[model samples]
Target: PPDDWREACLSNDLPEAGTLAVTLDEQVFCLYRVEGATYATADRCSHGRGSLSEGILEAHTIECPFHQGCFDIRTGAPTALPCNRPVKTYATREADGVVWLNTSPRDVAGQP
Candidate 1:
């Protein structure tokens, strides 16, 4: 396991193509499963206080229930109106039936 990785939950705990919210070290994160792959991001929507875990999951995107804004689950990039700022993302993976979440921010364009 990576030094910053922490066990989040069992892989089977997540519904297929859905979202789950988990708290680590007092921070909330939304976990997602899409096409057998897992992803993680800050649970709060960048545009509002809406909880991403309660929002709609569509393919690789999550739609904020507050304003109907959408974000790409893979990169946390906003993909719809009312959500221009990118949400914080974390590196996530599934191994041995367990889902692990990296405490460090996900690297994007060589930036973290």
Candidate 2:
């Protein structure tokens, strides 16, 4: 693993089209597996205190459990009502059966 990346979980632990909630350095994050890629975002819903990892995952969107507000898992964009603010998105990658996350927020182009 690279120095800037932190292992979040074993790749097998998060199957395809699944969500995983993880905490590192006292911060919570939600990891998702869509298609064959992995993505990470703030676990808390921007519109409420609901845990996004517990929400439903539809295509590339994650619906908040509290208000049913939806957010794009890839870009963290608000896609539904009651969620006007965007959640912070982190960089993620999977290798050697381990899921790694770059806690630092990445740019829209996916560059850190």
TM-score of each: 0.93, 0.92
Off by over 4 Å in 2: 108-110
**Which stretches of model 1 miss by more than 4 angstroms?**
110-112
* Model 1 error, position 31 (Å): 0.4
Candidate-wise lDDT, in order:
0.89, 0.89
Query: Residue 102 in candidate 2 has what lDDT?
Result: 86
Q: Write the per-residue lDDT of candidate 2 for residues 1-112, one digit (tens) a residue.
A: 2565788999998988899999986789999999889999999999979999999998899999999999999888899999998898999888899999988877765455
Question: What lDDT tens digits, residue by residue, belong to model 1 across residues 2-79?
Answer: 687888899989979989999987889999999898889999999989999999999999999999999998888899
TM-score of 1: 0.93
